[model samples]
Target: MISVTEAKQIIRANIRALPSSLVNLADAGNSVLAENIYAAVDIPAFDQSNVDGYAIRFSEKDITLDIDGEITAGSEIIKSLSKKKAIRIFTGAPAPEGADTIVMQENTAAANNTLTINDPALSKGMNLRPRGTDIRKDELALEEGTLLTPAAIGYLAAVGSAKVNIYRPPALTLIITGNELAQPGLPLRTGQVYDSGSFALKSALQLHGIRSPEILHCQDDPHELTLALRHALSESDMVILTGGVSVGEYDFVSQAAENCGVTKLFHRVKQRPGKPLYFGMKDDKPIFGLPGNPSSILTCMYVYVSLALNMYLHKKESLYQPAILKNAYRKTAGLTHFMKGMYNAGYVEILTGQESYRMSSFAKSNCLVILPETETEFKPGYQTQVHLL
Candidate 1:
C-alpha cells in the first residue's frame, strides 16, 4: 500500500498526453489550444465610429459644421470631410476618409444639415475607436495552451479563425465487473444490489466534457473479466473498471490486468472510501480499478480519473484550498479521510453518512474536506484543506 500522494504521482508518471487535432471554431469551447493563434488582420481593420453622431477632422471645437454624407454600420461607402464639416455616422461604421474625431449624438444638437456641439466637455478624438486599437495585424492574439472560453471563442471568430488546433479529449472505456450487481429498473435477486457505480461514473464523466464513453459489464468469472478488460484496453486510451479489485474470492481485476499485459503500479492506497483502488498501465494506456461502493467510486473518480484527463488535455490540475470546519470530527490515525462536505461563504460543513456504501450525503455536498492520515481528532472552527466539486 502507498500514500495518496504517492499513488497520484505514480499514475501521473505512467500516463501520456493525447495528440492535438484541428477542431471547428464553433466547437472549440472548453478545449485547450495546441498552437499559438496570431491575428491575421487588425481588429476593427479600419477606423471605426463608436457612436451615432458625427465624424469630424477636429481642427476646431465649439463650432457648427455642415453635415456630410451619412455612413451606417457595415457600409462600404467612404467619404472625405472638408474643414468645418462632419459626417453623420452610426455605431460601428467606418470613419470618413478625413475624419479623426467623433462627437456622440447625445452630446451634439443637429438641425437640418448643420450640427453643433452641445456639451462643453467635448474634446478632439473623443469617442473615436482607432484602427488596430484592440489588436494589431500579425500580433499574438491567444497563446498556446489557453483554455478556450466563450469570450475567447467570440474573439477567435471576430479574427476570422474558422478552425483551430486543440488537444482532443481522450476516448474512454468503462468496464463494470461484479456478479452481485444489477441494472436499475430491474428486480434484484437474492444477494444482489442495484448498480449505482455505473450511473454515477457516467454522470460524473459527462460533467467533465466526456459526452460518450463505452461501457461494458461482466460477471465475477476471471475469463469473462479478462476478455472485457482486453477488449476495452484495445478500444480506449484509458479503461476504468468498477468492483472486483479487493482480495476476495470473486475479486479478479488484478489477475485480469496481469493477463492483459498491464503493469500494476499500485494496488492500494492509504485513503478512506477507496483504499482498494488499483492503478496500472499497458504501454501508454492507463487502467483504473475502482471500488464498487457508490461513494468510493465517485471519490476515486474525482481524485484520480479527473486528474489524468486534465493532464491529457493540458489543463491545470485542481488545487486544495483552506476552509473553516463548522464542526468537530474524529477518526483513527491510519488512513486519510475524504469527508463529504458542503462549502458556503468560505466555511465547510462535513455532512452525515460518511460510509462508502451511502451516496445520499455526497449528492448533497459540493466538496470534499481532506483530513490527513496523521490527524485523529478535529476541533470546531479549524482550518482544513478542501477540494471543490
Candidate 2:
C-alpha cells in the first residue's frame, strides 16, 4: 500500500493531453484553447450606440435641433448628421456619420419635429460606442491556455470567431464487475444489490465535460475480466474498473489487468473508505480500479481521477482548498480519513452516515474534508483542507 500523495503523484506523472480539434464556438464550452484566438474584425464593426437615444454633434447641444430620421439597430447605410440636427437612435444601432455625441432620450424633449436638450450633465460621446472599442481587428482575443467558459465563448462569438481549436475531451471506458449487482429497475433476489456505480460514475464524468463514456459490465470470471480489460485498452483512452480489486475470493481486477499487459503502479492507498484503490497503465492509457462501494468510488473520483482529467487538458490545478473545521472529530491513526462534509463561508462541517456502503451523507456533501494519516484527533477551528465536489 502507498500513501495518498504517492498515488496522486504517480497518476499525474503518467497522464498526457489528448490531441486538439477544431470545433465550432457553440460547442467549445469547458474546453481549453489549443491556439490563440485573434479577432478577425472589430467587435463593433462600426461606430455604435450603447443606448436608445439621439445622436448629435457636441456643438449642437444647446440648440433646438430638427429630427431628420431614426436609426434602429443594424442599419448599414451611414447617414451624416446635418448641422443642428439629431437622429433618433436605438441601442446597438450604428452612430450616424459626423456625430460626435449622444444624449439619452430621457434628457431631451421632443415637440413637433424638433428636439431640445433639457439636461446639463450630458457630455461629448456620452452614449456612443466607438468602432473597435471592445476589440480591434488582429488583436489577440484569447490566450492559448485559456479555458473556454460561457463568457469566453460569448466574447469569441462577439469578435466574429465561428470556430476555434481546443483540446478535445478524452474517450473513456467504465467497466463494472460483480455478479451480485442488478439493474436499478429490476426486482433483486436475496443477495443482489442495485448497480449504482455505473450511474454515479457516468454522472460524475458528465460533470467534467466528458459525455457518453462507453460502459461495460463483466462477471467475476478471470477470462471475462481479462478480455474486458483488453477491449477497454484497445478502444478507450482511459479505463476505470469498479469492484473485483480486493484480495477476496471473487477479486480479479489486479490479476486480470496484469494478464492484459498492464503495468501496475500501485495496489492500495492508506485512505479509509477506498483503501483498495488500484492504479495501473497500459502504454499511455490510465486504468483505475476503484472500490465497489458508492462512497469510496466517489471519493476516489474527486481525489485521483479529477487530477488525471486536468492533465488531459494540460491544466495545472488542484481542487483541494483550505478551510476551518467547524466541529471536533476522532479517528484511529495510520490511515487518512476523508469524510463527507459541507463547506460554507470558509468553515467545513462533517456530515453524518460516512460508512463506505451508505451514500446518504455523500449525497448531501459538497466537499470531502481531509484528515491526515498521522492525526487521530481534530479540534474545532482547526485548519484543514477540503476537496470541493
Candidate 3:
C-alpha cells in the first residue's frame, strides 16, 4: 500500500490545467487569469478634479475674479484659469488649464456669482487628481495566474478590458456504484440504505465552486459499471466514483475501469477508513475510486481529490497546514491515518469513533487530523498535519 502523500502525487501528475478562454469581465470572477493584463491607457486619463470646488492658479490668492467657465465630467474646458481667477468645477471634471489647486466650495463664500476664499491654507495640487496617478499607461495591472475576485473584476473593467483570458473550469463526473443503495425519499426495504455519498460528494464539489458535474449511479453489476465508465471517460475531464472499490465480491469498479482502457495507478492506500481508495486514468482523463463510507469519501475528496483538481487547474496545491494537537491521540501506526477532528481557538481535538461506515463523528468535525506513517502515540502539544474541510 502507498502512503497518502504518494497517492496525492500520483493523482496530481495525471491532471492538467484547463485551457484559457476569453470571457467578459463580469463573468471572470473566481477564475484564474491566463495572461498578464496591461493598462491600455493611463487611469484618470487626464488631469481632473477630485472635489466639487473652484479651480484656481496657485499664484492667485487675494484677487476676486470672474469664473472662466463650468466644467463637469466628460466635458472639456477651452478657457484657462489666468492669474487671480478661478473656474467652477465639479467632481471628476477635468481641471481647467493653468490651474494647480482647487478651493472647495465649503471653504469659500459666494454671492451674486462672486466668490471669496475664506481659507488661505489651500496648497498647490489640493483636490486635483493628476493624470495617471492611480495607474500608468502600459503598466502591468494584473499578472497571469491571479485569481479574479470581485475587486479584480472591477479593476479590469477600470483598465478598459471588456474581455479577459481565463482558465476554463474543468468538467467533472461522479459515478456511484452499489446495489444495496437506494435513492433518498424512497421506502427502504430490509438490507437497504439510502445512498447519501452521491449527494454529499456533489454538495462538497458545489461548495468548491464546481456545480455542473455529470452524476451517474450504477448498481453493483459489472455490465452497468462498465457502461457508466465508458460514458464518463468520453465526456468528463475527471471522474469520481464512490463505493464498490473495496476488496469485496461486488467490487467491480476497478476491473471495469481497466477493461474500459483505464490504467490503474494505485488501488489502495495506507490509511484508516479510506484504505481501499483507488486512482487511475483513461485516455488522459483522471479517475478516482473513493471509499464507499461517507466520512471516508469526504476525507478522500478534501485530501486527495481537491488537491488533484487544483493541480489540474494550475492552482496552488498547498491548502492543508500542520497544526498542534490540543490533546494526545492513540494509534499503532503503520498506515497513515486521517481522523475527523475539531480545530478551534488555536487547538485541534480528534473526534472519537472513526469507523469507516459510522459518520456520526464527522457531523461534529470540521477538519481531518493527519497522521504520518509512524509507530508512536501523540501527546498534547504534538504537531500534526491537518486538512481543513
Candidate number of the best lDDT? 2
CA lDDT of every candidate: 0.90, 0.91, 0.84
Q: lDDT by residue for model 3 over 101-186, one digit each (tens)? A: 88898998777677788677888899989999989989999999998888999988888999998877668889998878999999
Q: State, as a TM-score between 0 and 1, how close model 1 is to the true structure.
A: 0.94
Each candidate structure's TM-score, on Cα atoms with residue i matched to residue i, is: 0.94, 0.98, 0.89
Model 1, range 200-240, lDDT digits (tens) per residue? 99998886668899999999999999999999988999999
Per-residue accuracy of model 2 over 59-99 as CA lDDT, tens digit each: 88999999999999978898899998999999999899989
Q: Best-fitting candidate, measured by TM-score? A: 2
| Candidate 2: 10-residue stretch with minimal lDDT | 311-320
User: Candidate 1 — which pairs collide?
Assistant: none
Candidate 1, which segments miss by more than 4 Å at Cα? 185-192
Off by over 4 Å in 3: 61-70, 74-83, 118-121, 182-192, 358-364
Sort the predicted structures by lDDT, highest score first: 2, 1, 3
